[model samples]
Target: MPKLISQINQLQQLGLNAKEGVVYQPSRGFFKIVYQGLILPNLPAPLRYFNYISLVGQPRIPLCYNAHTITTSAIDTATVLVSNSQHSVGHLKTYSIRRQCQFDSEQYKFDKTDLIEWKIPKIHLQRLDLEMGCNLTIHISENISNNSALQWGVSDYWSTLCLCEGEVFYKGQKYQVEGLGRFRHARALHLPFLSLCFYTCQIINLNETTQLAFSQIRNQWNIILCSRLDIQEFGKPVESFTEDVNLHIHRVYPKVRTPNGKEMYLPREFSWQCKKNGKIIFELYAQSRGDYKFGLAAGYVGSFQYQLSWNEQCLQGEGGYCEYIDCRPLRWQEKNQDEKILDKLMLLQPCLYKK
Candidate 1:
């Protein structure tokens, strides 16, 4: 077995040997633990989508954040990795988080000047078996680049690992709950009014020997910013590069109410084509199986669990699609006669409309 796989199994077996601690209540019903650590060594560099400051202008700074999760059914193990930081002209709000269990609890606070470090915590999941659940926490830290023009805020830097003991389906195959499932996301934040950004990422596990990850980002007006694709085989990097890319939304979920009662639309299915140096490389199609919603500073974003199939060159796998769009600009209310007249006047003047 790979060293990484062996280490994960040893950690997971600790859950079976250890006693359960006081239950930790997550913001949601599921149990969650946020810690920082280097779970994998010699991983590929992350794809940079856009720099908020460079694109939008200064005093608009860039922030960067990264989150990664890995799971395996063969050994019933799950792991999460995360790192986040920011550079800005002035201090923003101080962020803090507190999680308590019967025997242990943790509180973290981040200020403007302090560079936040990743925390790794040792955690134990209770009743981790078929139809049972398990939880564990550990602390880990690593040196990462802080020079990106994009930075994710302090509060957004943490990662959560949720484990449920049950039977889950993947690629129409049934396996005992041991190991082999994963989900991950990372982002950089900036003022909503300053600019608009769109990004899509997908990972396809072709088989035990190969995997592919791809992403593309667009600006507010839907102009392409950058795109990247990376390929790996047997846990070793094979190829990685930036390319011209296009993504098409084939199905949309329509507007749905958020927790705060605001409405947003999300894509449920999409297809993409990627090209390198003017040569078409691959085409991919993906459809969502379900959606998960989470809150953000500007608004709520939704992520869809998805299954993806690509050209034979790329293979097929399952993953997720997430979207974040501020609805304030799109929101409209009833207009009176005067407002309607103004609207018509603006429409009649092409120059004014352009302005």
Candidate 2:
């Protein structure tokens, strides 16, 4: 395939730099954005965002907003937020936010709400609802960025894959939304609770331009340092699989409970496969779609119903969006004593017990 579209246009030109923006560099960086189903039309209900602006190590409230309205079963009423204000990420043509990143306090009052504006390939988010109304906006209008953008390892992981189109204005009516979404800006030399490990991801759309994204990062003795799978399928280009993929994680019972109450256990099924030298290039399977969105970053966000298979073709994805992040060390959700002395000084870092 033209040498895989010239190696995905040389890894999307070493991933991002069309005037790169959104500051980083003063403590393990981070900048994220995620949208699932871009803005779909399939029986409404599939709008997501797992926003973040962390700079890792430097602490002090670093934005984490989490949007909602999902399904595979259910998930709504969500618009979580967190911030330390000081402008939550901005640049790259207004990389994000415009007003009230948060501040009215006397125990939270928040006034002007929110705003995001990018111009290239048009994007325009809005958020308002602390009684200020207007609640949603979204509007994509193109939002390019593809070739499964990459850049990896040693934690300087960059990412990209966008293909949206837009129209969404709930609470005042408006529909139209496209598919496939994800964009990341990274830099993390450590701190995932100092590498105790666990992270998972999925983003499947399978219809109007087939899509399927994958992610995995284990460690804490479970190995599997990283894994990625891209796919896309419409214009025919993206199809990157890293380390031949493997992923697994099956029927973990019902447990749940987080919001600091800590409980754990989730994964009512999962699968992954991919190979090259000895054949078999695809496989996937999913299940649990009963709604979940626990304290985010600490872990939880769910919805699934997939069934991919490649070479003999078989795609069936009725809503997909998954995430399961558990970077260990929740020493009872550390009620800060300087985070339990920085979790005993990152448990005497030995790279968290050898990877």
Candidate 3:
């Protein structure tokens, strides 16, 4: 399909200007889409397919489509590892998540961690500078494993929608993107867009890091800074995988837009958290979306033992900057707020872990 045909088909399916997606070409041989980071339930092995289409006068274009691949990253030989990771709301939980991940390809090992972070029941406007529009649906439990000894089978799906543009670093692959990027999570918000999309998620490897960011849009000026390092060691696929991470609200603010002359402006307000495992390594908070001159960071030496500057700007409005730190303690103005309530809830009813 040519770009024109693809656009036509996409508009027909997704609606005109309703949502847009920018694409990326995977780094040659290591090209593959990692669907776990998406906000859907149950990702397939053959995440997506790109068919090169060209007609008489037109050049080659990839007709991107979604499909389910029938290949496991590893064989169905399994063992188990029990993990006890901390929830963000300050809870020490112990449970056994099936060991289905193959951390080591050569050793023929399928490992599983305790849990994954669930971003839910949360106010997206709780964090400043970090603004997002995420949709969440409740998943009722179902029985998958027969013999009903424990009386539970299918757990809930914790997924959310994310539209972001920035440095998409994962599995040693870097995707510096311009334009609004839409991600449908595999096995978690895991679906595909009719539009040509590329995924280079880094979470496939536990040792790897995947960070998607948006440059700060200041005084109507925009820019971006993107650099990625890819790694392809541990992205193997599986049959059915699920996680139970708790969503906690750190702060919430009602969004407001101020009118500047003829232009109306909505300044972002936010701060929130959800934990994976036993530690609170991730928190949602905001930085100052302040007024700066020139938009070009000129002759500036900065902290973090390195320099910082913007290299490109996306024409789309999805790009913005300023890192949001975890504002847990400061986020609460109400006195006597304790993070240990979640602990009591878990202890009072441990069956909350089951369906």
Off by over 4 Å in 3: 1-269, 288-355
lDDT of 3 at 301: 8
> TM-score of model 1 relative to the true fold?
0.43
lDDT of each: 0.32, 0.45, 0.20
TM-score of each: 0.43, 0.26, 0.18
* lDDT for each residue of candidate 2 in 327-353, tens digit (9 for 90 to 100): 434342222234546667888946456
**Better lDDT candidate (1, 2):** 2
Supply the TM-score for candidate 3. 0.18
lDDT of model 1 at position 330? 30
Give the alpha carbon lDDT tens digit for every residue of 1-355 in model 3.
Answer: 3644544433223211212221112111221222222211111111110000000010011111101111222111121111011011211111111234332211212222221222332111100111111122222112111111101211111222232222222233333422221122211111223222111111111112222222111111111111122111212211111112222223323322211111111123333222336554333333222211110001000001111121232111111222211111222322213453655566784445655
The reply for model 1, stretches above 4 Å from the true place, is 1-196, 260-262, 295-355
Better of 2 and 3 by TM-score: 2
Best by lDDT: 2
For candidate 2, the TM-score is 0.26
Give lDDT tens digits, candidate 1, residues 119-230. 2233222221222112222221121111122222211222222121222222233323322112222222323323333445555445534555566654434444556665
